[model samples]
Target: MSRMKIALAGIGKIARDAHVPALMASDAFELVAAVTRHEPPEGARGFRSISEMKAALPDVAAVSICTPPRGRLQLIAEAFDAGLDVMIEKPPAATLSEARQFADMAARAGCVLFVTWHSRAAAAVEPAKEWLRGKEIKRVEVSWKEDIRIWHPGQSWIWEPGLGAFDAGINAFSVLTHILPGALTVEDAELRFPANKDAPIAADIRLAHAHAAPVLAAFDFDQRGPQTWTIDIETDGGRLALSDGASAMSVDGEPVRLDGGPEYHLLYRQFQALLEDRRSDADLRPFELVADCFLLGRRKLVAPFEDF
Candidate 1:
């Protein structure tokens, strides 16, 4: 199959770090142009917006929307209306309804739409999922703490109404939704919001699933040392641990060998599969879990989080 001429919309950090590099490495995609408000990335010329990019590069067949979660609807809808396939970053839209609308629009346009969960593409995820297929889960604990300064720098959108710690926490949920034996839902959540921001800086969330175990997760954005994204689970059968962002796993306190590799590579491969098969793969489970955290949980105000 010939390479799909694709455009990169949004030149943010993830766009530069993940999407651009993934597309460049994949044989299925040809980086035709880039749409950005700032200086374009390394290889492609910049366009002020997706519309401008589309107008200038009509040959582009697909676009990857890497913009922040807030107000991503219009750009995605516009791309669908223009008859171009789309691939969206995590937390596809602010709400489940809006996300469903995007999926519907893509279906109507008969175009490929991929909503990515990069964490699920990690090396140890599939192994863990296969290991837990029919087992009875007793309990789960997630410690997903990271330094916002190191990862996000000064990007303030994460502190806005929709993103924040959930930006990183959602990756844990992505892995959860992928590896779990059954459907998971938030029983309740305690969201700690900084006195100034509209989003939470830390969250203690309780999650439950039918016939499965209870889950306790703490999503913290103020870690000062080595970042931790680990899951410890106890089952009727044995114990499992997933650390290093689900790139490594262990069973019964014994290390498990996984094909430790880059996740973005797998993500792009899935996107290419969606394009080749003419199908849309948008899983709303992770996004819905975040929305559930906001809806079913109570809010608390904490000291204003000031980054140095």
Candidate 2:
């Protein structure tokens, strides 16, 4: 099969760290151009805007958007107008309403759209899901604490009005929504916002399901030392734990082997399959969970965050 000519939008940290490497290593797509105001990666051509990239490389059938979710709806609309399949990063849009429009636009344009949750693509996620089948889950506890200085550094957009600790916490929600048996509803939550920032720096969310277990999630972006991303689930069968962002797992104190090498690589593979089948894969449940946190969670003021 011929490789699909593709362009990458946004030349930020994530595009360089994950998307570019995955696209370069992918067998299904060719990275030909980049839509960025700044310099693109070493080999790919760079354009000031998506319009220029589309005009220059009309054969490019797909575009992978790695930009922040603040103004991503416009970028996606431009991609669709250019007649390209779209693949978006996690936490699809700034709001659930904007996220929901991707599918509608894609369907109108007859283009394939994929909104990815990278954590759910981790190796241990599927195996954990398989193990949890037909088991009675007693409770779920998530500790997803990380340093914003290390991960996002000086990204001011993260602390903007629409995102905060939930930016990263949504990954945990995504994995949980994917691996669990049923949908979760937020019961109550306590959100702590930095005095200087509009978004919250920490959140303690309580979630429940109609038939499944209750979930308690603690999310923080102010950790100084070792980072933690762990999900411990107690089931009738035994205790199941996922750590290191679901790249590693252990069931009842026994480690389970993980097969997928990198989450982004697996992510692109799935996107290729979607393009081949002419299908759109956009699941808003994770985004919805995050939305619910903001909707029903109580607010608290905290000390100003000054890591940047």
Candidate 3:
């Protein structure tokens, strides 16, 4: 079988650290070109933009967009118009409306459009999901905290009004949507924004299912020591814990082991499968939850944070 030639847009940290290595390891995909305003790192083919890359590498079958959420719709639309299957990174777009637009365009174009939730590809996630089947859920709690200076460094887009901790927060929501019993909507939230920025530095969210359970989610980007990404669920059977952002799982008191690698590898594998089956994998639930939280949540101004 011929490999799918793929181009990567927004060759930033995520593209370099996750997508690039995953594509290199996958026999199903060939990294034909990359589009970025910035320079591609060593040993990588570069194009100034996605349009330029499509013009030069017409054989490229797919494009994975790793750009920030604020401007993703136009890029995905352009890719769809070019008849390229598109895979967008998490928090598919800046708003739920844009995500719907992309879904409609992808349908009209008859191409695969995958909204990648990398955390869903965590090795232990599916197993945990399986274990939760038919179990009665009591409550769900998610806490994801990390130091932005350590993780993002000089990235400025995250501080923009439409971006920020919402990106990582959506990832946690994505995993919840995948493993939980059903859909949920935000009931209440408090977003804490740094005095100097447009976006929130932390968020406390409450979510509820139709009649079954309630979920409490907390996200903090200013955490200083021993960063955390954990989800704990209380069920009639026992307690299910997913730590390290779903990369590690434990049930009751027993630990579950998982194959270790960057989450993008499994994501690409699923993307390839979707392409092969002539299917689309665009799920907007996670993004919708975050957007809803922002729309309805109360806002609080917090003291300015600095890296020291």
Candidate 4:
């Protein structure tokens, strides 16, 4: 089988730490080129833009876009126009409208467009989904708290209005939407914007599902001791907990072990399979929930935050 030639856009932290390693380890993809305004590290095939990369590496069959959500539509549209399959990172696009536009364009072009939600590929996720299938869910709660200063460092785009902690929160919601049995809609929410920034530092969200269960999701970017990424549920079977952002699962307070590996690997494998099968994997339900919250929720101002 011929390996798919792949180009990476936006050689930032995620492109370096996850996508590069996953592509290197996979036999299905070849990392032929990269597009970034910043210089690529030593030995990396570099281009100032996607057009340059495609021109230089004509064999590139696909482009993986790791750019921020706010300015992704133009690049994605360009890639599709160049006749290459595209893979978009989590949250797909900055707004629901952009996501819909990309979906439509990809359909018209008849090219594969994958919107990756890496957390949904966690080892424990499938098992948790299976366990929840027949159970009666009474309530759902998701708490994702971490120190943005430690995780994001000097990155400034996250503080932009369309990005920030909600980005991570959307990832959690993606996994929740995947594992849960039914669709969900945000009922109410509180967005806490830092006094000095355009994006919110924390979000308190309420969701409703057709199962008649009320779901509450809380995301905080200011957590300090023992960083937490967990989801708990009260179901007829028992109390279920998914920690480490769905990397581990427990029921009735008993620990359930899980296999550990880089989640991006699974995502890339899935992407490869989708391309070969001539399928598109674009699910915007998670982002829709977040956008709905933003559209309907009340906002409050909080103390200014600094990256330190």
Q: Which structure among the candidates has the greatest lDDT?
A: 2
Which prediction has the highest TM-score against the true structure?
2
RMSD of candidates 1 onward, in order: 1.4, 0.9, 1.5, 1.3
What is model 4's C-alpha RMSD? 1.3
What TM-score would every model get versus the actual structure?
0.96, 0.98, 0.96, 0.96
Prediction-by-prediction clash tally? 0, 0, 0, 0
Decoy 2 TM-score against native: 0.98
Mind giving the per-residue lDDT tens digits that candidate 1 earns over 1-308? 78888888888899888888888888988887887778777778788776787788888898888888778888888898888999988878877888999889998989888999999998889999999988888999999999999999988788778768998999999999889978897888999999988989999999986645799999999999899999998888899999988988999999998775578878888888887799899888988889899998899999998975
Model 3 alpha-carbon miss at residue 240, Å: 0.6
Candidate 4 lDDT, 1-308, residue by residue in tens: 87888988898888888999999888999887888887664456888877777788888989999987788988988898888899998878878899999889999999999988988998778889888998888999999998898877778888888656788898788888988888898889999998899988999999887747999999999999888899998998999899988888999999987776889999989999999898998998888888888898788999888776
The global C-alpha lDDT for each of the candidates, from Candidate 1 onward, is 0.88, 0.91, 0.86, 0.87
**Model 3 root-mean-square deviation:** 1.5
Which residue runs of candidate 3 sit more than 4 Å off their true CA positions? 41-43
Ranking by lDDT: 2, 1, 4, 3
